[model samples]
Target: MPHQLAVTIRAALPAARVAEVSELLAEAGRKGVAGELFPFAEVTGVHFARLLVVPEGPPGADGAPVPASVVYMSEVDAPLQSHLTDLVRKAGEGLEKVFGHCDGYPTGSASVAARTAWLRAHRIPSAAFYVNTVGRGRQQILREARLREAIEEFLDQQGAALSGAPPSRIRAAVQEHVRGRPDLAWARSRPAPPALWWRIRQKAHLVALPVVALFLLPLLLFALPVWAVLLRLHELRDAPGRDRPDRRHLRELAACEDFGAQNPFTAVGSVKPGRFRRATLTAVLLVVDYGVRHFFNRGDLTGVKTIHFARWLFIDDKRRVLFASNYDGSLESYMDDFIDKVAWGLNAVFSNGLGYPRTRWLVLGGAKDELAFKNYLRCHQLPTHVWYSAYDDLTTATIDTNARIRAGLFADLGPAATRAWLALL
Candidate 1:
């Protein structure tokens, strides 16, 4: 189940404009593909909903409207998100082409008031969604009292022209008398209203501040206790038996073993032809213990439930690697020992020679299995790749060979580390 984000648009607009914008919104809804569109007309106003599916979980199953987590408002009879503003602008351009010019004025006051009410209800973060009615360019200066008078007169004469006057009568009259230019023709214009600065200020003061405070308060409260625990753990780092053996020393010992003339496990260059490669690259490491399970389970099962580890490795030009280590049991009893040894081995290899060859390590659990590797990349910040696959049943020989290639064992480290690591050899 995926979480759903619902957005509602409310506006007072001419029926034609409302229908036009709604059609565009419906088109966008279809393109989103993951959600549904519902339009409702109330006595007070008209509204529509565009629901977006998020990957977490289904929002609400019942027929009732899902409580909106985020809202967007636009003056043109539709609610729009920041990402959809471009589409709205394109639609407006289409309208201008049909109407000749969209003078910044609303076609009707009811529509204007409805839009204002909707914007106020949503309390969007910015005013960029609002239309600018004042004409753009040189004629913008003409948008003042003089232009309003001229436009009103023009509309009046146009009404008269519809009452059986000659076609050229209104055109000649407008050009010769109203416009005072024989060649110029009158085009419809809609000048945008002045920007709503005071409303923006009020939103910052009333809505933004409170929301910001609410968001920060929980973080501050949780961080204090977590920080205290971390400080206590930091104090234990220097305690007895805490002095661990450096990995570089262990690698020296490993190097003494006659594996081959070519450093079999070194990250310096490509691995020897017959050597095995292990997939140990990881991005996130989730260490779960009995206590964590008990906390969630209310003292049901004991020991270790599952140890999940995520790794992303570049296998070759052909494929990318994503794997999870699913070890069942108490982490302290079995998994910790494995991690300690593996970390020692990895540290020895990397420190003795150079940095790790793999790109990233992801430490995560709970729902890692549910994620399609490519889909995960789409929503996450991991580097891009052409293809990804799960390597759950990889053989030891294949795994080791792939590891060597992916780890860049044959590649030389810097001169300093290479000289040091290979010095003993």
Candidate 2:
């Protein structure tokens, strides 16, 4: 019964003000949270990501959805009725500068009329709008559990009916079984008690982590020049894929009408990572994701509509460290923000992975090859791109809602076709 709830407010602004509005939300999120760290490393429900609504329309001759409403969104976790109300009021203040006046969606905890209005608007199909920003990690796990259970239940119910059924028939029958009762496969939400490791890590990081980062800074800096030389040498060793990128992915992205704004140019690139640090690719990505994803969630970067979705398996990763993300601006601008804002931490992590001077210069993009990697991204990236939907979409959101639940249900369901059917639901 304890679901993630948030008082989502929508303010329509001119499309041009997306960046300015996003910055205000981030600033407000920081101030709203007041640097209040949650217990352990739990996600604070106090902040939210941007939701740029692509107006419903056909793409122009150029093949991009005509920009429509630029709605600012954040689902702050309001625990108490009073708190939710106040947060709504405070959020309105953030919107005023952009929307001017109190013209944005005005639903507040303190006001009965406003609250009732918002509720009335979402009376039907009420899953998308939320008030809290809890992480979907547990929800995702539980959802997968539910999907598997549903698959099992469907198989059992159709035991006699399925014996002579063809693949298509079996899939259709399973879909009929789960229809409006998708809840049959879902697990109830569980209480989130902070784990021991969380407690220890948080405590240690509070005092020790920063000092350690500072301590490691000079050494990381000193190794930069040496790292640059090695990365450049590596790029020379292994060149770009001779098979010109077919833009096969562009067709896929082109069909997508799910996000607010897009760069249209999708870059698909890969690097044959050096040996010494290649093993830790995932570990590094996760650590960095943990540290910086919040910044991203708080709108730290711009033109990042639907951050990393449809992350083409090969789009960002398919063996040998492939990465991808959409940007609001040009690739160069994206790289600049990345280096200035995020690269310091990434560089330090690379230092740790490559073992700094002990192993010395084996890591590409470790210290100085940041641009070298940028060049690689530029070269290999798809020249044009498209996305199907944004995270806010109920359909796409459900895909990862349980962390790719359809994929998880594959074993129990037997055929991928059956799993695919369930996913489409």
Q: On residues 1-425, what C-alpha lDDT tens digit does candidate 2 reach at each position?
A: 22233332333345666556545534533344311211111233422223233222334347764433333323333343543345334444333353442234543333645743543342221111211112433345345546756766778777896887776666666556655474643432333534556546545655574587689999979976876676546444543332322355334333332244333233322324444334334444544444433333322332233232212221112222222333343445555655555554435333332122112333334434554545434444432211211222232134344444444332345576564654444
Off by over 4 Å in 2: 1-228, 235-243, 247-249, 257-270, 276-287, 290-297, 302-319, 322-425
- The sequence of per-residue lDDT tens digits that candidate 1 reaches over residues 125-145 is 211111111112112322222
- Report the Cα lDDT for residue 382, model 1: 17
Task: Please state the error at residue 255 of candidate 2 in Å.
Answer: 2.7
TM-score of 2: 0.29
Worst 10 residues of 1 by lDDT: 126-135
RMSD of each: 29.0, 23.0
Best by lDDT: 2
Which runs in model 1 stand beyond 4 Å of their true positions? 1-111, 126-374, 377-425
